[model samples]
Target: MVGQLQIEVLGELNVRRDGQLLPLPQSKKTRALLGYLAVVGRPQRREHLCKLFWEVPDDPRASLRWSLYKIRQITNTHDVDRLTADHHSVLLIPQAIDLDFTNVASLRPGDLDTLDVEVLESLAAAFRGEFLEGLRLPRCPTFEAWRLYHRDLVLRSRIEILRRLVSRLWEYPERARFYAHAIESLRGDAASIDLRSEAPDASVSGSSRDVARGNASATANRAGQPGSELADASAEPKAGPTVGTPQARSQAIRFCRASDRVRVAYALCGRGPAIVRAAHWMSHLQYDWESPVWRHWIDALSEEMMLIRYDERGNGLSDWDVADFSFAAMVTDLESVVDAAGLERFTLLGVSQSCAVSVAYAVRHPERLSGLILYGGFVQGWRKRSPHDVATHEAMTTLIREGWGNSNPVFRHLFTTMFIPGASQEQMGWFDELQRITVSPDNACRLHEAFGEMDVSDLLSQVAVPTLVLHARRDAAVPFGSGREFATGIPGARFVDLDSANHILLGNEPAFETFIREVGRFVAETVQR
Candidate 1:
């Protein structure tokens, strides 16, 4: 314990002697200074450190010297000079010093159990309050950016770890402690559906390759990965535990055009008027098949009705060899799935981007729709890319193209901010892993391209079905304006704006539950199903 010094400073700042916790002196500035320097985990300019800790100083340099002195007096370390100095550069010694920042930074996907106890202790300690609370540094943009960057990284990493644990324990109701803690970390409403009982036979397929490797012929039939070999192998039984009875067989209905093997995917549950629900990007029907989040929502709609959920063409169990993804292609896919499912008329629930598709479907075939529900929807097509936005998108695509594997952090942040706003580090990590496994940059780009050109405003007026448009006031991705626009376009479309910002119904339980309840009642009263 004495030979190797482990200093954990990320969320909360704590110094330990060996494996045992050591009391750090109680001073706000000192702790802030130490945490800031430690977060750099590298050398920093003395000027930067001083500007970060001290706000208004008559002599800022001298103020830095005084703060350094106080920090040294409390920590009893010569490294104070290394973390701060006037002339020379400041450095935090990497070797022989153990800290949670190091551990959390070192974490990768698929290695949760191997995380050392010291790292956990350090994370628990550093995460006390908001970063550098009660203090605002002078106009140093570099310091401000660095402070935010480090804080976000730590928060994101911690959340990623917890999210993985939450996913793994999802089916184990016995691990309620882990689930409860995970939910608390997520800031998600505790009233969300439970994964265990609702999705008893559901399984989570880790990745597309995992999904592909198990069934090469099937993957080849779906065009396989991004590029595939056409050599046909004999069809083997599908992967996973097989249900002996044909009634229990969960088969995907394929929607394909003549001379085109690429198919749209749909899953059917229950019997009666078909209800179609659109999931966001990065869906795995095999995995979601088991997710209580999906099951509960679907089950609610499926009662006295036939419910259909489909995987968009480029991902999930759907055929992936399409040259491009467009609203037209997506619409065709939807039509195909409906055709295969043999649904003549149905209700539609469009979530997130899929809301556009739902609108398109209703507009195109108003005669076939009994009712339409739009949740967290947007109306703008990404085709109107300003120069800046186009540049941003290109840069994003480049970054994603550069790396999209389990270790990629860019996709992690992108996925987190898009879907799980304020998600924990663990959750982000798990999603990053899952996202990588589901679709590739090529496929994602195709989908993005489709979203870009998607203009459903014209179709709104043509919608013949009784439509309900629901959105969250605080949705960060698509502003509430999009929802308003969607409702305004569709004749007599009812618009409901909720108080929450969770884009997906899975995260917003009470609101979603109420939404489904209302929709059920609406369908009962409005539709002749």
Candidate 2:
């Protein structure tokens, strides 16, 4: 009970005195300042800290004083000398506190070679989440920038540790598989861990030679193609074979320039007739591949047809600082991705708001599309169809503006519950984190408002391609009745009602099996002709 103070900033900002948890200040800025000091591990000038956390005319120095006073109140109660401040600068006593990130940063490449498996596992588990996960201050751009840089640093470090474990334990396949899954969960399908290597020393440095080889093969494949240079330049690292399943591979992420010069990030997976998914909100190509909420769709659909998906402009790995978040801009993103893939004809799949974009695309270019699949979609958005919901929409927008990017997941949980009411705690947890990291709060509010104004009822009747519409019978996000109306507008569109309350079906649900079977059947029947 007399050791050093412990600070945890890997997942949540937490502190403990003598191994007993201590309560922190209620103010977010106060906790953030403490975290900044702990990670920076040196004295920071008062003016620098003030400008980083507070704006001008706000008495930043006074704000800093109050935060420092709060820090002292918390730490001094336990008689701990954890924080030090001078007239011009402040610092956290690194020797008096144990930090998770600091321990991880101190690890060397050689440590992985000689460390006991148990010790290595403990180190890996220390990185509970992204560095200061879900912590954001809308007014403090400098702090946010620092957080992002450190987040990436911690992420790379975690990846290296997992890679080393997989390599060092290559003799133990089950043990290696365990670490491989950990890497997969973190990096999604973007992870490049190979368990087949006989020599562990070859990977001691934690390099990804397998990924290099895959990129080489991809480069050779595109060698003679006209736009191959552009494709190669845009191609991200190709994911290697996963630990247990050799066939489960992720497509290399590539960028395509939209007509407006915005770069759109997209990925193509599996091998067969192409199936293009319209860009949708709350999607990250890298993260979604391993997400419990979206991985089922990727796995099932990619089994039969080559599945292509992309982040729409202003979301995910795409250009987030975009000026356009309109329906027109989203449709253009779809167009650019398809043209870049050089597909002659493909089936189109859309979910949620992107359903309207898919409808518009199918209507404008019927010959380029073989079929359409819409799930939990509506022709008219909430504002366009339901005047009574206007007040609710505005309130939701206000909540997003205020609470979207905070560490607490309550704001995001509101959307998650409506989308997947049947989700397990694990699924719900991932969805909550997904929304926060997918895009900025400003973009979230902007996208929300933009989707509300979408009115694609006219485009529905113009859709000439073969279509299948599947909707949960009791969807909370998009009503089941809207799904019926959407299907009825399109000529010869098959409508199926899934018996579920969740807007998006979970993988374990019976409705999901039915949804997947119906989709495969419809695609097979339509594509043969």
Top lDDT prediction, candidate number = 2
- What TM-score does structure 1 among the candidates reach? 0.51
Report lDDT per candidate.
0.56, 0.75
Pick out the ten consecutive residues of candidate 1 with the lowest summed lDDT: 190-199
**C-alpha lDDT of residue 328 in model 1:** 70
Which is the leading candidate under TM-score? 2
The digit string of per-residue lDDT tens for model 1 on 276-395 reads: 786467765544543333445655666666667777777765555667476776766666555544455678788888898888878778777888888887787656545765676667
* Per-model TM values vs. the true structure: 0.51, 0.61
Deviation of model 2 at 278, angstroms: 1.3
Worst 10 residues of 2 by lDDT: 193-202
Error of 2 at 199 (Å): 34
lDDT of 2: 0.75
